[model samples]
Target: MFNKMSIINKGILTHSFKNINRNFNKNPEIAYTIREKIPSPLYITTPIFYVNAEPHLGHLYSMLLCDIRNRWELLSGKQSYFTTGTDEHGFKVQIASIEKGYDNPKKFVDELSLTFKNLADAANVKYDRFIRTTDSDHYDTVKFFWNLLLKKKYIYKGEHSGWYSISDETFYPENAIEEKINIQTQRKMMLSKETGKEVTFEKEINYYFKLSEFYKDILKILEKKHDFIIPRSRQDELISELKKMGKLDDLSISRPSSRLQWGIPVPNDPSQTIYVWFDALLSYLTGAAYPSKKFKSKWPAIHLIGKDIIRFHCIYWIGFLKAANITLPQQVIIHGHWLSNGIKMSKSIGNVVDPIDIIKYYGIDPVRFFLSETSVLEHDGDFTEERLFDSREKLISKYSNLLMRSCGSNFDIQRALERYGKMNLSRIKMEEFPLFDKSVIEEIKQLQDELNQLAKNIGKSMENFNLHSVTNNFIRILSRSNNLFQLCEPWKLGELREHQDLVIYLSTETVRILSITMQHVIPELSNAVLDRLKVVRTRRTIEFARVGADEAYGASANRGGDHPITRITKRTSSYPDITIKHQKAS
Candidate 1:
């Protein structure tokens, strides 16, 4: 019998993929298991966002996924590289530019690309490189990559005919197209069944990549690495699709320059411009300073992308790399689109959530916490004004409230850290602290052990590329610690110095460790937490997240320990609420 499993994250139902029935224990190892530290010289990336549309929550989420992974490596004291930028070449960008009446598409892409960069800055995305396809270096790289493929005889001129999507910037197989009726105009149209976007018949001569020849090579990568294409549903989709087609058709790699003049020209052949997908995919190499020694030393990158373009990234990109003899990316982490108010965001419905507007309405770190905490890694997530409001309350009430309690005037967190924080777990003798009641010591030890275990749970989840588990783990630890603090009543233990000291030390240590872990998601607020507790700037890496890791800290002058979470209400937000006019025709 097929077991119906509902995989959930933070209460978001993630097992929503249809027709994905599986037997019990078919793929058991996908469970979250503790793993070793991710090796150094790490690279992480988000797909270059296509400039056809203005920035949305979907785009912001992708950038956040990259930043979370990138910052984790940074916090762990490893050398890391991260890259995210705009995909400025393509039919979609060309049409959008003309519709806006811009005579030069470069001028058009220039404006859109800056918006993405600004958004990344506002979201605290510490990207090492922000490459634009129009960059001269990128143009050169795409040309060189194309010439290498041509020299390898993996590319050839051919006549191509298929249904094409301007929105998707790729051609669709015949089985993927569907006939649909326009809701408003009652007009019949052909649309990509996968994307629900309009597709038109196209016939042209273009350069083709032998994508079919690398089908087995790509499949072997998926089969070899079970967690390679994460969120098993996406992996199953590709595997099922591959099994359906023994081998894929050769992919068209160019468009006539006369028809699409806004892209990189084919090497030595100006009449045919390289396909935008090919040009855009080359941004990854260019973003990393490709062909330079600087790019070669890192491990394969971890790519974060939205599920809409999985085919391009997984099929075309993997095939291209296989042919080029380049190592495949460490993994392709796929996420689903965000819906607005229980409905898929649509311009016609006037319900698209402007990320900047939300950022202005809510503080940045809270927004980060909300996205990272509530995001369903495997399936679509719904975003509503109420949910955002609730998430902010959670940060302040549950987490910040605990901070105020543990570090308030009633307890000296600095004194607690200085007294007992230096003792290593293995070196400590439990019988030495006999002045306090054995039960009080026992509870304090339990909390300390629980606090220590939080890092293990969080690390394992993060190692598996599950940010939802990481953020939720933070919330769970804080909530439990808060409950224990209330029960222990450290305030009433006036004569029992050892009892009070142990309780306060473990509690404050919880906040310190939490602050370091939270830095991966909420930057400013986590920094604020550390600053309020007087945690030194140099002692905030992942190494200092344990009990005895930093004994010398917690003695500095306290800064903002009074209310602790006033950063949300008091600080001036860096983003504006200005909404961009939707350019799509109604």
Candidate 2:
């Protein structure tokens, strides 16, 4: 029911607003670009990952969500810029490199950053820019941003004191820090209630951003935009917290370079280094060609990030943008972390999952499919081999088997498609149906109605960025198609002659829709499916994902039991079981 514009464009922030600071550029330019460049390529981003550790399942899940949204935009005849890379500069990475016996932090980050890049390649996460904090342009941008903030009086030298967690690389308020006993040492220690990481009271003179100035501004934006953050509940959580506190503390934006020597130094002060988060967040802008004369990217990309990083993004990043007069991002999406077999992933637990190994064992599409099928925003999703195996099997049995049965060995699908695929059976009266049983005709009508519903539902889902609902819509239609296929017994319908065409027409129509709609989630497999169905490339976009979108395509759809989705073979690679996390202790 959606037009192409409706499917591809989530219009600018629906509310208009005056800037809290009269000097700030604010949303007016953001709105101008959104309106003027309506046909421009969409922009999407994933949080530049921290490089203290190797890539894990949680990292892949974040990429999967970004890739899905980007692919959806692309398939709908829109261009999309996708950016993802490493957050290489941080106290965590500095200490981690020292622990790993690396003398040069650059070498350490270089090696780890490639591992993330390689993981993206292996997982088929097609990123446009792999921006790194260490990149030359990023260095310029960070310095430029720093000077701009200083010029605006948003930066001031101050003594910052708080409960600091080296592991988390952030400060926590007094109320957020609590004493807890270290289980292994059986010793009492202060831990951050927010992250459960041990925190030590640290006080130092550093550069602080006047973050408190923008507390009300951010609260106003959240209230006005209403949908600025994805998965509404999280946005509501932030709004509630913002309203309850009604104030924010000035944020420390730098550290003494003697203590943290591996980061970007402040604009004029070499003795001080910019905060890791302050430097890292600029990767998005740098990747988008920010502050350039030839600014090709429209402002306000949709940023996909993990829930753990929401506070930093909503509070610090927003404050910095407001101060620097940069356009605020259109939206931010927070996804829940992936648990290893229902246990939280932790290095101490030895439960961290290396996603590339799984991708190598099962191939990219299955892993992509599994992640897309699991809804992460509601809560943490548990990734077990059994769960993966189950999801893989259900897809194979329900969709692949259906494809094999309807288009391959069990029926004369080609003949049926040739005869009836172009006809709109819904427009014909009930009396015109060629059927042996009245239920068969009714079933055909039901399948046709469901196919129409599939189109409407997917458009709505994609428009609203409800990713899980898209897959659910596909599964529902696939199930109904399977049921209709079973009732008609198209394999047996051939000799009966009249009933065969109707059965094949209805079932293959459903398969065609499934193939088209599912292309965004499982691209490689969907390509293979479309190839097997003989569907031409041009018709593979979203517009053609209808019941009878192609009649000329199924001339060669007879692959017997062979379907791309039916790849349930024993994996040739021996993937380490990540689910053993809780059972095996470090």
Candidate 3:
């Protein structure tokens, strides 16, 4: 009964070549599980946006990438929770609201925060909770963390003298400060845009977090857990610089109530309010349903942020967590600033891009693909309309073209099955199909190997957020698959009677590979490909099959095989109509 099993299995068996190579040195005695056991209530968060400004391309890129990761984990059978929202309490927000003639900070912040929520909705970001720093729950949580730290002697009162940028919501040392003179007013300015004016305030006494105490521990953590930060070079540089400095001064954790009344008040003292960093970073906990017993299970995962704030995330955030006796996030993924046409993207430069506008014009998938593709996780890259247009074209050619050819061919096969009855005349044996031939069988094996290697590389890159290499590799594989389709001419073969079975075999295999690759970037397209292939949607794990029995025979023979063929007949056209237009006749 099973003698022909091996004989009829060659085509389906070839798909396992990559899997076999991946586990080549593993012992057969113990089965290694590829999936990790996900703890319940998984917590993931993006840096909360400040409501002082509207959303931009840089903000969208970080949030959308985090959304993609969240969705992927959910699809992979993990209980995932994602949190994103705006920081409503800050000196900048206070100043901006006052400038708008709004006396009530809550009302003003509520209006500004909605813009960020709308942007998330536009991008299809499914955050479990949208945290507002001004929300009572988040305020309480921030107070709780602050009191805990103070009681532990990790916080103390001090006088902080520094140059602060209101626009940036950051304090700079004397060396880091830039000076500017107002030509019209004929006055020297410190360029603190948060106040929207150049004004220097003298030093003030405030509560400060003891950041220097955890300096050694932070360096040790970085050294021991190198994977804790993405882009190893960035991590090394951060750790090295911090070590050279030896210790940093305690961070001021409060703003005078008179200066910024919009912030959360310090727990023990009503005279001051918590600083923006103290309140904003606490969103990670509040958004996670923190202080609940369930949140402890999913305490840490990853933190995604821009390179400008790497020191805050990699150093200050870690120090705070360590002092609070909380588990640090698994990794800090840093990405470079998004520049426009070789200049920093800024409204003053007239080069600022709105993320919502891009999505509306180019579609969500293309925008997501472009950001991931053009961005190098470790270093900065320029964002240009030309680059986005080029990436969009490549996506259409590589994945979209393969999708149409594979499924369209499968549609043809289903029609044949309907006319000819279940294909029973198996003309070729599994062993007779050489794994190295230029035929469909060999191509399937090669694609499977390439895809698996790509996945592994992506995994390694993700350990330090090296997105440029990962996205580039995806493009390369997509190009190779497209070239394969053209050379084999599977569409031409589908029309011939003698080559009918071969066409069905090739089409089904192609659809399988396309479906798997699409799962990573464009999931909706992947689903459309699966539906076209006539595969029943089930909980059965779909592993990429490199080699398999040719579809010369239907699902009748050994339907119980590891790789079973299930017929799918329902079809709806879901692919994009991508037409390239030339601006001028060449």
Q: Pick the candidate with the highest TM-score.
A: 2
- Candidate 2's displacement at residue 419, Å, is 2.6
Cα error of candidate 3 at position 340, Å? 1.7
Query: Mind giving the per-residue lDDT tens digits that candidate 1 earns over 1-586?
Result: 0012223321222231111122113421111111113232667889998898789999999999888877887787666788899999988789899999999999999999999998998888888889898899998778767877887789999899999888777788888899989989999999998888899999999999999898888888777789888888789888988888778889999998888999998988998989998988878888766544334444367888888888888999998877776667888888988976566777776778888877876878888888988878787888876677778888888777877777656566666666777665334445765554555456566667766776667667776668888877788778877876777787886566665666677777888898988798998988887887778899898888887677665553333346655544433322212233333432
Better-scoring candidate (lDDT), 1 or 3: 1
Rank candidates, lDDT, best first.
2, 1, 3
| Local error of candidate 1 at residue 163 (angstroms) | 1.5
Tell me how candidate 1 scores on lDDT. 0.76
Query: Could you estimate the TM-score for every candidate?
Result: 0.86, 0.89, 0.77
Clashing pairs in 2: none
Candidate 2 residue lDDT tens string, 404-505: 776755566677777777787766555664554676676677778777677567767765556678777777778878887787676776566557777777
TM-score of 2: 0.89
Candidate No. with top lDDT: 2
Instruction: Score each candidate by Cα lDDT.
Output: 0.76, 0.77, 0.64
Question: In model 1, what is the error at residue 78, expressed in angstroms?
Answer: 1.0
Q: In candidate 1, which residue ranges exceed 4 Å CA deviation?
A: 1-40, 183-186, 422-443, 556-561, 567-586
Give one digit per residue, the lDDT tens place, for model 3 in 397-499: 6655555554452335544445433333233444543332445555555565565454445546544444566568766766766676666665555345434
